[model samples]
Target: MTSGKAALLIAALGLSACQSVSQFADPLAPDIVREAGLGEQILNSGDPNGAVRYFERAAAATPDDVAMQRSLAIANMRAGDLRAAERAMDAVLASDAATPQDRVERGFIAVRLDDWERAGAMTAALPPDLDTARRALLEALVADRARDWSAADAAYARALAGAENKAAALNNWGVSRLARGDASAAIATFERALATDPKLFAAKNNLAIARAMRGDYALPDGVESDRERAVLQHNMALVAQRKGDAAEARRLLERAIAAHPQHYRAAVEQLAALEN
Candidate 1:
């Protein structure tokens, strides 16, 4: 899937997901806050682009409003506009009113941006007392990047322990297991994550990936949308490609296009890439 709809969400916890524009009290213009609030509602409704429109209005009205900027940053991230998020988050961090959550948000963005060094810096600078689960998850991701598997495992444990959202932590752990080439273990972990939170999209998507890695090409049980199915098929095709099963990858991409209700350009493109 594209980054906006999702990315297997192996990283990028989407820290600001379904959260209010600002965790702190809103002392700014009510109009800006209300506009941002509408953006948050729209974001939660799965229209990041629509959310961005509302957030951009808020930002334009009060460019210096840190709270508004916070919402804008997350809105842009959800919209798959990391460059916009980067600028907004950087401005947020530069302000005296910035909070630890803002820094952590930046760290996730950095990870998505493939700037592991910057992400690590933000992770290292994070305070120990705030949102331990997210902090530990960040540490785990950075550790995994450094090839420090032991550190990653330990941090994932801590993340699960303090996780306000246990399914998310478990899902990430499952992805980490997949990264380690433990498909069986990853499947079990993903199953556990799903059992804990049946609606966790990443767990469902990752479970399909795990199964595909284990040589199962069937779609997972709960993916109801054709678009989602197409996305999952594309992901499985990538897994097949990675395993050098070009034939299987091509077949899956073909299946992806067939399953899609409309033009699945991504699947078509992947098919082209695989064939060529």
Candidate 2:
């Protein structure tokens, strides 16, 4: 039996040829088509490493195919191969078939590559009305990196105004505040983020970090994952240490390590230090 990905690929290929298999004239050979389909499935499943391997093979077989190149570029970006992604996106932009999404992704790639000039150029070329929230967030990040606090603040406000998920923007805003040494504002922003989305782990983590920075120890509410709970416990342990309670700190660290063995490396190290 064909897998779901394979079946989807076959259907897409059939549609491309505008006929059933017996009379179909697919532009790509069966093997290449199958690989591309599997690659897309892997990408959708969030396994960019696996997707990259399959996409690389399909791209090698169909170098002139813009869609395949775009897939390869996205897979590479997800897999943290920014240089390869940039090259592939450059090829896509050079083609006549590049879309607005392509430009947005390429602009993000330029941001990740720290090519600020290129990123600005790409952002400038984007259609003004497209993906306003995402564009604003990206611009905010770029401005933050450049230490343009005023620009970052304005862009972040725009992001929050238009974003569907305000938790991310709030968390990032907290981070920016923390970077600027406003611990009180950062803590409040992180709390607001948690109130907006209790399941936002980044916000939870930032909240823990902000509390730790202020020598305050309190367990975060509404955390659902053992790993996140462990992180919170670890942060509490740090608070204990800051308060000169070595025994309590050790206990908290041990509890953190017990809560999530896979995510308690810092707790383990801290426990060992306390013991020593």
Best by lDDT: 1
For every candidate in turn, the CA RMSD to the true structure comes to 7.8, 15.4
TM-score of 2: 0.71
Estimate candidate 2's alpha-carbon lDDT, on a 0 to 1 scale: 0.69
User: After TM-score superposition, what is the CA distance of residue 132 in candidate 1 from its true location, in Å?
Assistant: 3.1
lDDT tens digits by residue: candidate 1, 1-276: 332223343233233111111221211122222343634466566777887888789889988888877888877877788889899889999999877767777887788788999999998887777755666777888987886878989998998887667887788788777767667877898899889888777778788877876679888777878887888888888777766799999999998999893767888987988778
The superposed Cα distance between candidate 2 and the true structure at residue 254, in angstroms, equals 3.6
Q: Tell me the tens digit of each residue's lDDT in model 2 across 1-276.
A: 123332332233221111111121111122222334634566666677888898889889989988888888877877778889899889989999887667766777777676878877877787877756667766776776677878989988997887777887777777766666677887898899889888877678767766755666666788787887787787767655755778878888888899998766988887998899
Model 1 residue 82 CA deviation in Å: 1.1
Number of backbone collisions per candidate, in order?
Answer: 0, 0
lDDT of each: 0.72, 0.69
Give per-model TM-scores: 0.73, 0.71
Worst 10-residue lDDT window for candidate 1 reads: 18-27
